[model samples]
Target: MSGTWQCSPAELEVHLGFRESNPQSKHAEFLGPPFLTVCCLLPSFSRLDMDRFLMRNVTKGTTTVKRKKSLDNDDDVETAEDTETMQRSQKISKKNNFDDENEPQTERIETLCQTFSEILTTDLVWKKVIKSNLDLSHTILFSKGIANTVMELLEEEVVYFTGDLAKVQVFGRWHNIPRKQATYGDPGLTYKYSGKETPGRAWPPVVKAVRDLVNRVTGYHYNFVLINRYKDGQDKMGEHKDDERELHPDTPIASLSLGQTRDFYFRHQDTRPPKKLNIDKVQMPLHHGTLLLMNPPTNRYWYHALPPRATAKGVRVNLTFRKVVPAAASSSSNNKQ
Candidate 1:
């Protein structure tokens, strides 16, 4: 039982007396008082919905600090107050403050559990997930284009290796490819798009299809997409974002998954004891042939990753689409054949 877990105090109750109870009788009449008493003795355990209650009270303007640790002191209190003020100012003054292209994205991806028909039929402002902002027709066409393009890249021998995000292990095992301005999707794993500065053509159609899917769903055209292949449960990406210089400010990078279901987890950009989100329980099981679009403002507040699961095995491919403008193309290659 989780209560038996030794990691935290809250876990004690889960295992409390279970070992003895099992030996006594299979159907021993165990009333709730012991559990209730144990809960009462623990810190903050008496309240079943403590966090929710605290959050609700905060919103309702009832301010109280439920518990304080022995580590607290006058200096600590002053520092906490100062930190809170600074965070407030930063939130107000900053826009996409954590844009590290190498860092995993900071948007919490939501997996819609609604029935497929209900999702597709509902006339929400964002209907179906396609590449960022691309129309349905364009989405199809671009996918075809990307497939052809990647094939060509392979044929031309431009790519040294073509694999999934998990296979490369560029980022740490527990993290996803980060793509914020600071780091930009774990550079070690992200395909070397412009690193060598080759005058290669735009990403081939397979890549484009991936890109188009993201653009249509997220409503932005990413200039580039670094494709990574993860074959089986062993492969993984670390936490990072796509805040690269090439990425337009506020552009949402879209990811399209193919070939396997993987858990995609997300957490807030910063953490305060009460502010942490329930990310571990809320991860999306990214299914094969699914499109996930992170909202543009997502980076400013959250960070996401593809954590490894022991149960997962087999290959999964993800195409993260972005828009990159070529300096040479913009200046002189406008009409060149």
Candidate 2:
């Protein structure tokens, strides 16, 4: 047929492999192999018929493809009619395939999006359970066995960001500090890890606290965490959503605030007058050992930020535990901090 047989690259590779494995016998070699090549030129056709078939098929497939050969070699090639018939058929098949591809399969697509959203957003009630769970984990932090494990992690999971400051931008504010943009660009303590072999070590006491709490409360297993330490009240995070493409679009983001309680604010992204929520919304003082669960639509609809306090308060440590899918580890772009 005239048109290029549209096929996946993977399929093409398989076809080529097949060709290498088995060469055709002399008779069929002129026509093409049984499976791979288009049957455009037939042996029964006269040379003139083959030329006409070739021209027709070429026109049918696309005016774009440039096939080089002498059409006048009637004896060597099939009749033009046969060639034209094959070409027209191939072109129609390609057009049909293209139409099928472009049509939207809405029901299937919606199902996928629903499944993805379910994975991303945690249930609301679990946020409360995680809060209680973190309280229990605090006891484990001081235990001898736990302390030893933590010590091991401390030594193993220390990641240092040295050299120039990395660029960090938030809400149009730009911060260019030359340091690794922590995975998913989380705003937390950029702890120094010992080596790649010791990656999981970064999640110790505080990390475990969040992890266990999230697992118990929401049935989520968090694989990675970004810990940010704000030394003074001046250190703050501007309004932003944790929608970095690296994160699983459907998984929930669990944030645990330890140490001092800074005023956390939330606003819907697209609303005029911007509906706002504060620490008071949770009916808690935003004290030590607080966990906030940002479920699905929460991110899609709102943005959160920890504004700087006018007076310097105590140091604050915030850990954001996420179900990181490292499969999508795209290199950080200039858009991130």
1-337 per-residue lDDT for model 1 (tens digits): 0000112222221122111211332222221111100111111111221211111112222223232323233232323433443343344223222212232222200101111111211112222322222211111111111222233332332242322421222123332222111112212222222111223245543344434445544557566555556656655554434444444555555665655567664445443135454432224555444455565655445444565555677666666555544453233333333
Q: How many residue pairs clash (N, CA or C atoms closer than 3 angstroms) in each of the candidate models, in the order given?
A: 92, 44
Top candidate when judged by lDDT against the true structure: 2
- lDDT of every model, 2 decimals: 0.35, 0.38
Q: Residues 1-337, candidate 2, lDDT per residue (tens digit)?
A: 0001224444332222212111231111111111111122211122222342222223222322212456455345434544565465445334333223233434323322222232221222121212211111111011111222222333334353333323332234553321122332223212221111112344434344435545665567776676655666666554445665555666777666655556654444443123343221111223343456666655555545555554647756666676645544323222222
* For every candidate, C-alpha RMSD to the true structure in Å: 22.7, 30.3
Instruction: Evaluate model 2: give its TM-score.
Output: 0.41
